[model samples]
Target: MSDAQFWEMNPTATEILNEVKARKIQEINAAYTAEAQPLIKEYPLVEQQSWTAQNTEARAYLAWHADQQGAAPGTPVLDNILMGRNGETGTETLQQLCLAVIENAEMFTQFQQLTGKRQRLVKAVRAAEAVEEIELISW
Candidate 1:
């Protein structure tokens, strides 16, 4: 079954699942942004801001676009940020968002893919986490 279809079919279970999924997503997002804010801020050119998962992909695209338009890839461009936020320029917001996305893509994608009612995603994340812990212990 399609992902949306699977979700729709079991609405009751999905509701609870979605809640837990959403909470996890929020926690991931919050942690990422909180950690990234200081890193981006340390670089004078990049702006520090919080982003939601729904807008991340579009934002990343915009960031890439802006960089191509003479704005430095990692630098903050006021026009790009405003245009991206307002959808004024097809390239601007997507550029800023894109850069932001690239900076946090790994964590964001994990949060996105794991967001569902199924147990597989959780199992995978836990497995990965366990592996990481083991690696760290060995180190």
Candidate 2:
């Protein structure tokens, strides 16, 4: 509204305008949340694939780790495989296994960093009081 028109508004009209503005803001916030929710939910899966693709050794270890029922890090599984124990043949050389473990560790560290950044973005989105503030947030 023009300053002159707004200044001339009756109390009832001003009240109604305020209510309309509040409602519009609520709708904008809801829409932003709807758009952001799916991205938050699917981020891990999408990032995992992307990260693994960029790190070939990490990808190989991931597949092998899955076949081993998702072995935890710091386990003696690699040693056992090297020693030909636990029904695991010494198929992978020590150097290959070591590289896989190192690469996997590095990949995991990167994943955690990205995930933490995403979580912080989520917090910023939640705490924002205006559409413009929320719009500044990125994944």
**Number of colliding residue pairs in each model:** 11, 0
Clashing pairs in 2: none
lDDT of each: 0.48, 0.54
Residue 7 displacement in candidate 2 (angstroms): 31
Which digits, one per residue and each the tens of the lDDT, describe model 1 over residues 20-135?
45445455556555655644555454233334432554464465575666644443344455566777446444445555556565564555433432344344433443333323
Residue-level error in angstroms, candidate 1, position 131: 21
Model 1 TM-score, 2 decimals: 0.26
Which candidate tops TM-score? 2
In candidate 1, position 58 carries an lDDT of: 49
Once superposed on the true structure, which residue ranges of model 1 sit more than 4 Å away at CA?
1-11, 42-139
The local lDDT score (0 to 100) that residue 137 gets in candidate 2 is 57
TM-score of 2: 0.36
Worst 10 residues of 2 by lDDT: 72-81
Name model 2 segments beyond 4 Å from true.
1-76, 79-90
Q: Identify the leading candidate in terms of lDDT.
A: 2
